[model samples]
Target: MLTVMGATGNTGKKVVELLLAAGQQVRALGRSEPRLGALAAQGAEVLAGDPGDAAFLTRAFRGASAVYVMLPADRESPDYHEAQRAKGEAIIQALRESGVRHVVALSSLGADQPEGTGLLVTLHAQEERLKALENTNILLLRPASFFENFLDALPIIQHQGINADAVEPDHAIPMIASRDIAEVAARALVQRDWSGIVVRELLGQRDLSYREATRIFGARLGRPELDYVQLPPEEMRQAMVQAGMSETFAGLYVQMTQAFNEDRVQPRAGRTADNTTPTRFEDFVAGLALDSANP
Candidate 1:
């Protein structure tokens, strides 16, 4: 049996679906019962519990040959990194006790760097903890900025014909679709032949500057003149706060943008190859158009 944490999330849902379609027995864990009901109906054994709860994780990992692990960040926590570390410790303890042979961890690019990568420090910590497990094969999936992240900018793009951020307009950053990340995760999970820790970096197609991305998005939206704007850090923070993020969380997000803009949050060469996954930005946006038209 394969256990999937964060089963209600974007990548997790795809992973669970792929595993189920392959006739693999899936145990899906999430915090929301209503959200997990769909997966349960789809023939997954759904468990509702907090990921950081040790007893809960132990129960979830029971009888599973391999598990997919991901930690959802708690921006409202007073000490976010500490919370993440504590959660990591719990997951490691459970894995050691449960005799699970393989672990597929959802980490981020730049997770190998010890410093300067603000929120990503938690991912690095988790990777470190996982490495200490003896006889357990671990696959670290380090994906770049998700194209689905731009869904938050959709309202602004549709109304104002602009895509804006705190990062410099000319700076090129790697981006990948979440579907691609799921595809890689599913492949790794189903093929349990590999042992030891394997790191995979999912960089979609190529790196593109925000300006170039704006032009591409504009072309798809039928607004060829759509523009990209770079806001100051404080302005970006305030915008996030006004959009319903806590002040502390908003500030952290601005700091993350600073790190990205300075090129500090990039990954070194790991096990990256040609991933045969579909759903590029244009294709994703085209689906969005269809959804909007049908809705």
Candidate 2:
């Protein structure tokens, strides 16, 4: 059995689907039983509980051949770092207790640094904790900024006619679709061919700047004149807080953008076929256009 945490989330749901389609027994974990109903209907053994509870996770992980682990982002948490750390620690403890020999963990590109990566610091710590597991094979998937993140900008672009963020508009960075990350994670869970710890960077099809991605969005939405504006850090933080994120998480979000702008957070390995995923920003934007149009 392959156990998947965050089973109802974007990547996790897709990972569950992929595993089930491949004829694997999957234990899908989520916070809500109702939310997990869809996966349960699809022939997965659904386990609903708090990921921060080690005992719950231990029960879910037991008897599984491999597990997919992640700390889903919580922008509303008053202390995002503390919350993520708690979940990370619980996951590690459960993994040790369950004696799962193989794990495929979702992480970020900047997780190599112990500090200054803002929200990514949790992932860095999680990576270290996973590495300490004796007699376990762990694959750390370090993917780029997600393409789905741009969907958040759709409203701003539709109402204000511009894309905005704290990152430099012209500073190209790797961005991937979450489904692509799920694809990698699913394959790794099934193969389990590697021994010990392995770190893989999943860059998108290519590096793209905010300006470039905005242009792609404009072309899809029929707004050739649309532009991307690099918002001031404080301004963006306030906007994020107004959009319902906690003040602390909003501040960390801006700090993470600063790290991106300064090149502190980036792909450690240069782009290669092995690391470059197939989904392009254009493809993701196309789906975004369809969703917005239908919604």
Cα TM-score per model = 0.90, 0.95
- lDDT minimum window of 10 residues, candidate 2: 286-295
lDDT by residue (tens digit), candidate 2, 88-175: 9999999999999999999999999999988888899999999999999999999989887877787788778888999999999989
Off by over 4 Å in 1: 155-161, 218-224, 270-272, 275-278, 289-295
Candidate 1, residues 42-149: lDDT per residue as tens digits?
999999999998889999998998899987877666667777888898899899888899999999988888766767878888999999999999999988888777
Global CA lDDT of candidate 1, please?
Answer: 0.82
Q: Candidate 1 — worst ten consecutive residues by lDDT sum?
A: 270-279
State candidate 1's TM-score: 0.90
Task: Give every collision pair in model 2.
Answer: none
Clashing pairs in 1: none
